[model samples]
Target: MVNKSKVTINDIAKAVNVTAATVSRALNNNPRISEATRKAVQKAAKELNYQPNNIAAALRHGKSHLIGVIVPRADRAFFSSVIRGIEEIANEINYKVIICQTYEDLEKEAQTIETLVNARVDGIIASISKNTIDFSHYQSAIDKGFPVVLFDRTSDQVTVNQVVIDDYYGAYEITKHLIDQGSKSIAYLTSPIKINIYKDRLRGYMDCLADHNIDYDERLVVESNLQLQDGRQSMEKLLSGQRTPDAVFSASDYGIMGALQVLKERGIRIPEDIALAGFGNEPFTSFTDPTLTTVDQLSITMGRVTAELFFDQLKGSKKKHHEPHKTMLKPGIIVRQSSLKKGLNQENSPISEEYKELP
Candidate 1:
């Protein structure tokens, strides 16, 4: 085989009649460089098939312009919105996002995080899985001085930049809304009440019930996997009980949808048989048979803010110790036909329940 020619920035610079520094800046599209020089340098670089070594550039600048986004499920509506938000900003900022889905498995989360770290990403944004208890992988990222921003389902173990919804306040407000609708015995459907968001949501539900002087009924609080099938099964179990709940406040939209389907099949009139409300104002909520009243979390905005946070950290302009930044955006409640009853319980006055307070 003939000897291979090694391409270098110097070769491109010589061809464009410019300094290597100028060629480098032009290759990176630095705004400070003149557009004419950049175009010329780029054309020469392309003609010579010059490929800038990203690994060397990263080593020199101590940045890779790559961010890792770890989530439980990328296909979920909430995660999809968040990814869109992140990708939009990242693209604008000349950055790329490497998405990693752990599938709600702790071991998989550990492996993905490690892989991202090995890739030498500039930063990371993550939403911990329900099964995650140990945070050694997270600590390792922090130890490496790599910025980590947590969003949605974050862990309480490590102090870092975070963007999240006010789960407690949102749940409290929704529960209080159910009580305002004259729902005395409202059932609370949710996943494990151990995670911070769910725990806070459950607390809000209980606090609202207490505020309304409604006795706490353990039987009314049903815990499930928050899946569609689990929702139907849990609701069926609740309906089979001695007493039926007047309303249900679910922390999951999937669960609510499943329960709603079963209730309709069983000829149970919504708002008449049971007033229902759920969280995560998914798009399908509006298209349901009787539109759902649910919590609208600006997940996309959170994702954008999280990406911004990572960018800020990567900027390296810190004066004092980087104070942990936590953003809690308030959730809006969308009230639809599912929560409104007819006849005596009919609501006449229009109440703008959707788009509530922003935390």
Candidate 2:
């Protein structure tokens, strides 16, 4: 009688009459392992009740085969989709993921990175919190050649590899769509410039207005946390102001939801009375009283690319991206009823309704 909990991979190897090395590769799902032999080894392990020890394996290889994923919050559709994308690619390579949420707190963000490092994770993929202006935590890890890949929300202060969308382009196109719909007084809801995404989006909106010969109004630009409450406050400020905006464009979908609430409570008709647009094509955007016109960040694709960049930084990886810093994928602008003053069919964009791949 053998103890099921005490059965190890070596024990399973003996039962299958295969070398321990073969068992290890088979268990790890190495591509080189034949399917028949892999199945036989797995069967032997199951029958023997072999219990694999992750800690022991990590000690032997100096790698835990685990990576940390840090996001602002997983409750949102965008972050959750990005996580799914990351996990899919990571699992394919036999690496597991440990997800952490910062809840937009800078302290928690730094602590999460340290904890993952202490656990000896092979790498980390993170999107910084809104309040994370200081890049010291990420920079410290990068200085030591630690694998750190940032996505979506990132800081220019860090020199690490990053996967991000063309924020400027997304903003420009969305704002242009509004302008073409006769939105001359378009109010902008934005955030602090510390994070490059907001800054780029703001730049895009302003540049688009200028290109269309529209005067840039400082009173129409409201900067806040880009949350739902912040959105509401910003929208109120725009409405109560001496000059009323015909349209409102928020840097985030969360913020736009708040603005939408304010608009609805005030009995303002969407698109007709006040056109609205938002970044992050969050699912709730479509379910609103009037669907929202927003930018799709390609959350899942961003995750896969982030994972790939992390692997490129790994020591034994075959493919090395010489200059990964230039990796910037295109963004998709989704048009809907919320901002389509001229109706949905009139949207002069290749990116319409659904997210399309970049050519």
Candidate 3:
């Protein structure tokens, strides 16, 4: 075994010719010290090979300056936006974020929540996975007075601060738009309607049909996992039907792209044959051959607002006033070439007039 020397703040303070509190203030960026004094303390710290032990600091304060951010999949563009927002607020308040991906597994989500609780994180921001249903893992965190804010996806059982988009209104508007554009036979391509977002979207689609006296045709609905391949396969099955849909509304950008690929392969003209629209307003949507019409969820704003909400909770006073609150952001529809059939017939471009920048 090798003999290792322990490094302490006192050692750094001595080397810097200052008191331990000054060193601590310098390291923590307390804003009370002069700029020159901070620079000196920092240089001395670097020379001593000093590393601030966050664990020790937490032990002293009885709270960790860390926030746990949990999501179903880190690869998703929507979740990425939310994480960025969380980070923006956290950095401003001297708090750090520990991100965990659950891969849509309830067990994994629970394990990560428990681990964060054990680590004594001061707060948590989470979007529950599609498969998650249990509340035991989250209960301990809530009971311990931890600030928990659920964004995008939340559970009915967990009564905490929540930030979500208006999925129902967005979906309803798009479906009704298609119907108004003379899409008498429209099809809905979406994921499982078990979660709040998808379920709300499906409800919006159904409401649009019901309000217009259009019979709900079960044959026109195709439920898949919202994968690229699912889009292709689902569209192929729809195209094979005797009465093909004149328009299709998908709940995901990836799914829309997949359907577009299949449609293009079959030499089908967009909006002329079968119009298409999707959600998420992905970056690639605008660059597509016929720019994809989509629902802009303003994911980055959602993330930033969620972060603001988390910081508000940390501030104590605001948390007391805002706990058990909910915030809902309206989703905007992005009209593009893929869904501009009516405007084209009228010698006017709907894409130019209808597409607006999302907040």
lDDT of 2 by residue, 297-345 (tens): 8988988888887887875433444344846879888888898777755
TM-score of 3: 0.88
Alpha carbon deviation, residue 276, candidate 2 (Å): 0.6
- Please report, in order, the local distance difference test score of every candidate based on alpha carbons: 0.84, 0.86, 0.84
| Most lDDT-accurate candidate | 2
RMSD of each: 3.3, 4.0, 3.2
Estimate, for each residue in 165-187, the C-alpha lDDT of model 1 and write its tens digit. Answer: 99988899888777777788899
Angstrom error at residue 229, model 2? 1.7
Is 1 or 2 the stronger prediction by lDDT?
2
Give the clash count for model 2.
Answer: 0
- Model 3 shows how many backbone clashes? 0
Question: What would the TM-score be for candidate 1 when compared with the true structure?
Answer: 0.87
lDDT of 3 by residue, 189-249 (tens): 9787487888889999999999999988988899998889999998998999866999999
Residue pairs in candidate 1 whose N, alpha carbon or C atoms collide under 3 angstroms: 330-359
lDDT of 2 at 145: 50
lDDT order of candidates, top first: 2, 1, 3
Shift in Å, residue 137, candidate 2? 2.4
